[model samples]
Target: MKNSREIIVDILLKVEKEGTYLQLLLKKELDGFESLDKSFITEVATGAMKRQITIDYIINEVSTIKINKMKPFIRNLLRMSVYQLKYLDKIPAHAVIDEAVKLTKKKGYATLTKFVNAVLRNVDRQDIILPDDDLSVKYSIAPWIIDSWSVTYGPVIAEKIANELSANRAKVSARINTLKTTKTDLINFLVNESVIPLPGNIYPDEYLYLNGVNDIASMKSFAEGLFTIQDESAGIVSHVVNPLAGEYILDLCSAPGGKSTHLAQLSQNQANIISTDIFEHKIDLVKKNASRLGAGSICAELYDEKDIDKFVGRFDKVLIDVPCSGLGLLKRKPDINFNRNEYHIAQINATQKSIAKTAASFLKPGGSLVYSTCTLNKTENELMVDYISALGLVPDCTLIDYVPDMFKEFVSGGHVTIFPFVANTDGFFIAKFKK
Candidate 1:
């Protein structure tokens, strides 16, 4: 019964209130999206989410009513409308106002639609105000996150990271599925399809960068399993492990199975890869990916980190790609910035430490181990590596072995911290070790 924008408003409000991931919510709502307007739906939903805190600041600055006093629906409605007015230059203010007012009327808030219409009509597009004194508010990020980065890396570097995270065109990267196609052939295919394939700095032969193409999943090459949408940082993880053919490998937290399938592809389908996830139902994702990629070496399993004792000394190499506060993915997933907090960091890091320590038992003595996270915090990266090293594993391998030669400096003490700007990819922290 509702249009795309109205659905987005409902989804965004529910995401904020219920702490749901925007990507997952969007996928659930846009299951049969071609019949509807998927592009406009995604643009408004993600644009409003990415500028959420800033939109609220602008609303409170301009509106007579405080945001806290407004109903949740009104607050989200105002946010979506203000976002369109501020960022979407092509969309006229009157169109946004009309759509928002229509939604309000349908919600039986006819009296409030006048107030919404007035607020939208009065916003001066020429002049806007933001938190000038605070970098966090200026970038629409949490102050504590900014403070952490400032203390760890100087203010200038922290601001640069914030600027990139808040406003940057996140590049699309995909690794060629070696099982089905060669990198050269894939590049040729992409070029033939009019999709520019740029060389990736890291994992040179395995990854390619591109832009402007949407619905990668629906691409002919993608359906043919020619490539998988993976960042160079994530693709590098499987390379770091360097699984030899016929070796047994364990991938903890392997839902969606990017790294696991990469391991299978890299090993030429000779390695035995056990892709384990915490939830049984989610293991289906690993199965689906393995099937699409033709990675016959991968076998999906349900095994939570809490049950790590059952898997002790079971593999030649182990990948503890433990979960952490997904701060590294701000550019890729804007909802992460709004939902994550210091408490989440603490809880996730605790689990990370536990998982890495327990997964060590599954690696034979002298076997390789890689502890990785998609986060920028030292507590989750360097500290977790140090904690694992303290637990009887020794840092033995070179960290920069998997990245570009220029990134050798970031590799020190057997771990590499891939900052957003420094790596021009997801902010990931990786440590290589041996039991």
Candidate 2:
């Protein structure tokens, strides 16, 4: 059987070669490794991906041969080994180097095994110098992403935003079901099993900074549907919507049902919520979450947003959490930075405008429409909101000032923008409007 290091190395190579998401690919690779804990596997995979740019820089700086000219497998192997040496403090440096050398030799790269060992040794002895002033290194993001962020948030805030995205993300957070159990009861339950959870300010249901509970799906509370894993920022959206019992609500573009489920829960499962998504598979996800949360009022459907005539003036409240460039979530999904571009941004903005317009069509006179995205780009957030307003749908500005006291820190110019660094949650933009 392969050891933990070997499994991690193989996973990293697949991620580097196939451009697969590290989380999904690593989960699949480690599925059968029952003896290995999920946390350890997550650490290895996430650590390697997080430090990829720095690893490539180090490899290039030390190698006698050009890194790009090296075989793909060899380059990946070096990156994995170097990541372990630099980040896994529990592992002895000598053992990391020795194992890497052994792996290189066994792979028939005997000619380069000595070179690999020498390079790692030199790296261990020196303080790594990253380009702190360069936008790419400072943000630990690709050049294109840094440039895009600068255009969106301005250079100074963009630099801060980029720096935050590169930092270690907090553990997954979840909102405990008050209908089933209290937060204290849930914390005590997790504590009995060595997991620690803390209170979150974003909502009464939220618990933040949870650790040692990576396999939360397997926990008794989770299986019993006593809680649902959601980001604090997302939970805040449902609060902003503030659904009431018996109200007719529409969740436009709702899928994977994060906010919709929360809306149902907040309404005591008494609201009528028509949850719509563009894809059939995602509609199923909404149904599953609603079922798990015991929220039967959330009706899921697959429908295109551009065709709003079917639901014109139907809902008392509407949530338009449109698709976006996902810039606000860079810390959680680093790969997006590597793949997204200017053209993609423009396309997403157009989509956001279309969806916002369609969602507005469903809101009855004096009804509220909440617009949101997991992105910081003005084109996706503020501009989209402005476009909807230009159609003669003005927002209740007083409502903006009345954002829950818990989220006062995130409110800016009548909109809520959550920064990952400041909020310890995914970056999000939220605005509420009324017709």
Candidate 3:
């Protein structure tokens, strides 16, 4: 049987080699492990992936062979080992090196065991220096990402963004389904399950920040759909939409239906909600989440956002939580740190503009539309808001009322970019407009 370290290395290898999402693979690979082992595996695997750039820098500083020249297995193994050595101070360096050697041999790299041992030993003894001038290397973020943030948000905010993303705080936000359970009741359930529930800054009455929730799937309340996992920032978008009872709401590019289902709940299940996504499988996820949450008013459908002629001007409210570069979710989804780049941002921007345009067309002349994204990228957030407003939709400054007083300052001209540090939630953007 593979030990926890081996499992972690396997998980990291797949993430680096195959672009597997670290979170999804962890769920599949961690089954049957003890809680402690599971935690270790998750931390090391995720940390290695998050700090890949920094880890590679450390490796190259100590080793004659650069990380890129090494085999994928060796590259990831060294990265994981370096992460433990540098960040996980609790683990002894000798033990880490010994395990790396053993794992190298086990993986049919017996000839390279001595090389691995020597390189790791050098890393342990070397007083490695990070390039202070290169924020990308210091933060393990790509250069393009660092440059974009620095230019858009300025150096201080950009560095804070990097720091927040690297912190990787473990907190899960759960939104209570008021139609089924009250906040007190859900807190009681979470307490019964040994999960600590803390008050959420945004929508505290309907939201809780959970800790020690190892397996949400095992929680009876979760299976029962008493609440759903959603970032308080995401929950804010639903409120910004402010769906009303008996109104028609169109949620374009909606899948897994977080906002759409929340809209149904906010409307007390009385609104007619059409939630759509291009992929049939993603649409199925919307249907499942809506059904599980008992948001019966949500109608999940497979439809492309680019083609909205059939439903133009037919809805009282329209929500376009368009796909973004996901830079804001770095703390939650660290894989995005390495996977996304400048080209991806440009491609997504066009799609976002198209979706925003189509979403405006979907709204009636007097209807309200909320455009949102879980990203800190200005091109995707502020610039997209500009593009939408240019299409003649008037910015609705009243959106400031829907958010908490603390976030009100971020609101300017009906749009706000919620920094992760400011909100203690995902860095999100919200813009409300009237067609």
Best by TM-score: 3
TM-score of each: 0.92, 0.91, 0.94
| Candidate 2 displacement at residue 296 in angstroms | 2.2
lDDT order of candidates, top first: 3, 1, 2
Which candidate has the top score in lDDT?
Answer: 3
Query: Taking the tens digit of each residue's C-alpha lDDT, what string does model 3 give over 1-435?
Result: 899888988988887778888889999999889989998998899888888888888899989898899988888889889999999999999999999999999999999999999999999999999999988889888888888889988999899888778765746899999878999999998899999999987778988999887888888999999999999888889888898888999898798888988999999999999999989999999999998899999888889645667898899999889999888888878899767887899999999998888778888889998999989888898887788889999999989889777788778898988888875788899999998
Candidate 3: which pairs clash?
A: none
Give per-candidate clash totals: 1, 0, 0
lDDT (10s digit) by residue, model 2, range 297-352: 88898896457687999899999888888887777776676556778889888888
Candidate 3 segments whose C-alpha is farther than 4 A from its true place: 304-309
RMSD of each: 2.4, 2.4, 2.0
- Give the alpha carbon lDDT tens digit for every residue of 1-435 in model 1: 567887888888989899899988888887666644777778778888888878777887778998889989998998888888988888878888899999999888999998898878766453666767788778987788889888877898789888888887568988889999998999888887779898886777888997657678778898889999898878768878888888999998898899999999999999999999888778998999899999999989998656767778888899988888888888878888778788888898888887887788898877888888888887888777779888999886565677566556778777877777865788787789987
True lDDT of residue 403, candidate 3: 79
The CA lDDT at 183 in model 2 is 77
Q: What value does the lDDT take at residue 365 in candidate 3?
A: 82
Alpha-carbon lDDT, every model = 0.83, 0.78, 0.88
TM-score of 1: 0.92
